[model samples]
Target chain A: MAGVAEFTKFPSESLKVGKGFKLAEVDPDTTPGYPGNKADGEALLEELDDKLAELQEKLFAESKFGGTKRVLLILQGMDTAGKGGIVKHVLGAMDPQGVQFKSFKAPTPEERAYDFLWRIEREVPGAGMLGVFDRSHYEDVLIHRVHRWADPKEIERRYKAINEFEARQVAVGTKVIKVMLHISNDEQKERLLARLDNPAKHWKYNTEDLKQRAFWDDYMAAYQAAFDATNTDHAPWYVVPASKKWYARIAVQQLLLEGLGEFDLEWPKAEFDVEAERRLVERS
Target chain B: MAGVAEFTKFPSESLKVGKGFKLAEVDPDTTPGYPGNKADGEALLEELDDKLAELQEKLFAESKFGGTKRVLLILQGMDTAGKGGIVKHVLGAMDPQGVQFKSFKAPTPEERAYDFLWRIEREVPGAGMLGVFDRSHYEDVLIHRVHRWADPKEIERRYKAINEFEARQVAVGTKVIKVMLHISNDEQKERLLARLDNPAKHWKYNTEDLKQRAFWDDYMAAYQAAFDATNTDHAPWYVVPASKKWYARIAVQQLLLEGLGEFDLEWPKAEFDVEAERRLVERS
Candidate 1:
């Protein structure tokens, strides 16, 4: 906690969405509260790594004992917006055992047969674990709205369902951090071109991405509408300017650090009689 | 693949168990084929990091396309023999998304009702993923034998069941690397004492570990019996020297490297027309 103050300048509060916040107005290239360049941002991330790992271990310890607190980081964005990058660079700093990661693809026929949130509810991180959702239930709204896969009336009902669902998560001690990696249209085009140019990166290129890019504006409008309905103090949305990958990595790491720091995490007391156990171990 | 030859001295072939291998013959303090001190071993691990990460991502990419190959690393040892350490220092180097890890504990009533492999079969890693088991079905034989919880006749049946189960996994494209983190009684004592001294580590200490310690000789014999019964070329067992933590880490890392490198993993060819997709992205 000693060196954590340096990152307080770009507190999660600055990136949080409030009433009437417009997604179109956010500059995808802006580094927001971070004043440093790429090198400096990377250095800060390296410094924050130990703190994040320590807190995560403590949270894991708490869960094994009597603590019920856990975290779920939901990443929502268009393809090539750096969701996978953040998973590798930011959350990757913690031990794999402490992190529960799930990447949602197209739902199976069985999943579609249930309520939209049914599959999502099953993947929630248990007490003391850090759960990460690469593409989450938000897709049901974001992609569904953009493609008109569901009627407008049904889509409207989903926003309220999402809010209530998230509130219940908060009530159960899960600190949900929902993030939209905001990258410009031009940035995405550049990324896609870079993927196409490298033979090694060909596996990452999906033709569906082009179809999604065609409806970028529609997706943005859907995002804003969903934000207006679902953004609450219990589980607020953070729009990370992801054009500079370094800044987004550090920002997400800091947000998680701040979330874990809120809990007064101390080691649990020994459950058994220490002296008796000590004598037994000494003799053995 | 260039510098990988440097580690050929400790190729997994050297550690693989054959008929009549004895657990007591292994010196937990020895570094086996690793011709290096602690600092040298640590440095080598750092150098191997990028190579391991690259191979893992290729495996993941292959899974998404059409590869069925996968790996499962099983770790078994007396308490405090560095199973968790190997996971943090070695498997932690790969992308967390590509590595699927599960730590088995005492089975619940639900788990006990089915055949022993019921829960284990459910957790096997899918295509192109690296699966790790902190403790596994081997426990059914090891602890059950030491405790006499299962009669001798029942215990004999489980060894054949485990071999058949693993052979099936190998036939279906899983390269199972089973390892026993061999640590001495002195090392276990020191580690247990260290845990008792640190409040933060108290949760990891269990009265059961001490109870299990009282049966060290019995447990060793039980392990040897298991090795004699179930060791097969399809799923080989390696005895990793656990006293020197750095040596164990590097050895396990090398074992996994060789496992993944056998696949001839080239970047997956583009599934769609690359030039056409490039043009579509450019115009979008």
Candidate 2:
């Protein structure tokens, strides 16, 4: 029954981005917050499942009965930085019904016609849901900035717009947990090569991923620029080390557990007369 | 390592609705296909998780590579028949990313404005997704029939419309597995009473659910009529005995496995040349 904080060597606060936070200094290979090896980390994750599921159900129940609070887990990472893996392992632990999962690929023609946040705003989780964005609005800032798809002024505007958008979300009771999964260039290369080496994994081996690899430094700098602009107290970013897949998964899981714990979620009080309902059921 | 078929005393085929299927005759307390006790069913569910996950990923992968095949699991039953439990335990075993879960409640103003199928068609899973409807278009027939919300002619028309809609879905590689989680009225009363007894479960208790109980026989007859009309080779109904919670979970899990198995799903062949991608990764 050890709490997530007890299992982690580094508290979640230590992983939080603060003033003068630099993404470059993070060691993607290091298991930040958690001191456990793979086996230990996996065990801790399994242990946290029940607590996490209960907390999530409480949030979902609260939403059903007029609670507006919802958590948005925004994952921003380079290719092979394990964004999808975090989703599969962390958010996967909760009821799929409770999790509003959306993976943003390149914008479609209809999406491109609208403002960037238009598509995003439409997908925000309603009260009592866990909203997950697998490569979300941050893409506008990251890829849009890297490819110079937008003018420098427009790109700068997007950062401000994103901050305000998130602030509005917070004002309306959203707990935004933005995570940047940091992985080394060498690790990315190894993963890409590994995918190529296996036929079964070939479907995941995107040629564009290699093309994007050439711009590794640009993406990092773009991410850093993004973190500097949009990391607010209302919606802070957590820089998770992703060189070790196990560490990345566990850290995100703990971050989510910590996020849900903040709600101090209690199951909503019975709205009906319990005794009367019991009588009604018995008579039926 | 046993296949799902071996664990079940009754195969999924027997559970599937055929000509002259009688909802009244179905013993909700009996574990039709599954012979094992609760503990064994739980164990088997745990064992099937890995294979189920693998098959689902393959289906998802296929969708990414231009495969249009998808599976839609339609869950319909009276209140407290454990629809939510099936979702939590069965579909939950797979990656949430691959499962498109939707719970259809009473239609909204906008939904009521459109044809019932309009709201439904919008939520149908895209290629390679496992779409789940907690309660579906069948509500139009069941509730509508019980209350005469729609005239007899209109209700009859809806049955034809639903069959045609499902036929369209199947024509385009959608495998529709409609399941009615059959729980006896007695079992439902016990569940409702149990919910009322627990403070934590208060949010789940709806006064309307008890009111629905009075119309139980009408609902059952309506379901039988609907089944007799709509059960087709392409999209059929499965009546699962849901009084035993563990039995329902494992049976749905097996149905899903069998549905996915029909695809003979294989990993998509690498679209890119292997040597070329390997060299690119090596150079990067």
Candidate 3:
């Protein structure tokens, strides 16, 4: 593992994934808040709400026409990484009916029998649905590789399969957005302590999680490799600096708005037979 | 059609299906909320948020163990009955990753060929997932019956199937919550006018929707029947007065907290290789 100072200084910008997928850093510095900094992000949140509502109306209007565009959002991170919090705060303003969220757990006996992506494929968003995956297929690489559940060769093959899978979704008009919530180890400790200190929040803390935390370096290495192989123009990873919850959430919403903005979602127009409907009302 | 005065005296709580199913009406005045009231409800919202977050932590703790528990919440209503607003503000406090939402639409060619529940069953929450259905299986009884899309006998059969299906879910330990967003026609007109008058909201209005509005009486009858036949101890429907969005949202959060509170979730004892974790951290 790198020194604390060295790790903190790690260039968050210009993440070089692989040969074909060099995602330009969406600078968190440009965002309203940063770690060691505080602002009343709630004011900006209201503005975001207004914009989101407008966008949502457009999306719903498109749905009235049976529009088929779908968006898949994947959030992956370490323990106490704030993936759940980010999702809640970011989508705080949108209508929930338009969105579908899936949180992957350890594979069940049924899931294990099938291929790795089988369960995940089942959860993928249909046309016109917004699917948010909390700790997605990447788990096959993260936990499986770390625990030796799969051999290195198999893990490598799975990584390629993921890239191809995402590319296929994009080709079929599914916009995919992957976000990695990046936080410092010190900040993670603070959050874990916070969870433990509050009785109501105590349920969120698990000492068993520290075992996985011990493999921080290995997980980081695994993340780098997976990002290298899977990040592509079709589905890119937005490494979000998540020390500040508000800023991290807004960053995700911005990415989603940009992705969905590419679609021309117009409401379908049809004439209404008011008299017929009224007669039907009388008969019923 | 009933006159305005007739509507004023209508017993909104009564739900009777076909011939036999008759769900006793609880007093509508004491149900959730009513028209022109929200000042006190705002404070209740903050308290609701605290309560819901606590329940969410417990739900998360349960997920840490091997098996997953999925909760499906269904919200059905007339247009402008506050379905969108209820979903937006109630789930506004819960963790998004733990919840997946799906709003049903008019069946497409692909969907019409199969049984009505096919697409919906596909959207069912996986283990550890919470799913919210906005206008769900009830549509077969409500819209289909009201519009004469199916015979009354078929609709009655569907009600039986729905009852058995929900009972099966309870047998398997799935907690199902169904809420009917109830609003008066007067309130609906005010909301619709508000949308039409606001430029930003004009996009939400569809001329064709007004034709459906003409059949408000028929839809209400359909809804009453649907609720009566489907409401059971395993999956009861809460009739929520949604003239006030704040009151409605808070009510939903409270109901959800109560539902999940039935499960006294505790964290599995912390079992971590403490020495191994410390050694790994020290080595790093």
Would you list the rank order by lDDT, best first?
A: 1, 2, 3
Model 3, residue B164: distance off in Å is 2.8
lDDT of 1 by residue, B17-68 (tens): 7888999998999887777788778888988998999999998999888788
Q: What is the C-alpha RMSD of each candidate to the true structure, in Å?
A: 1.8, 1.6, 8.0
Model 2 whole-model lDDT (C-alpha atoms): 0.89
Candidate 2 chain A minimal-lDDT segment of 10 residues: A2-11
Superposition TM-score, candidate 3 onto the true structure: 0.74
Q: Among these predicted structures, which one has the highest lDDT?
A: 1
Residue A247 local lDDT, model 1? 86
List candidate 1 stretches off by more than 4 Å: A1-5, B1-8
lDDT by residue (A10-86, candidate 2, tens digit) is 44787899899888888888876565678787887788888888999999999988999999999989888898888
Q: Candidate 3, residues A1-284: lDDT per residue as tens digits? A: 12111112212233323464422343323343222223435444545666665565566656555766788989888888778776677765666766677779889999999999899888898776777888999999988888888999999899998998888888876888888877666666667666654555555556666667778768877877788878787787767767767666656766677677767655444333434533443443
Q: List the lowest-lDDT window of 10 residues for candidate 3 chain B.
A: B1-10
Return the lDDT, model 1, position B217: 99
Give the per-residue Cα lDDT of candidate 1 at A203: 94
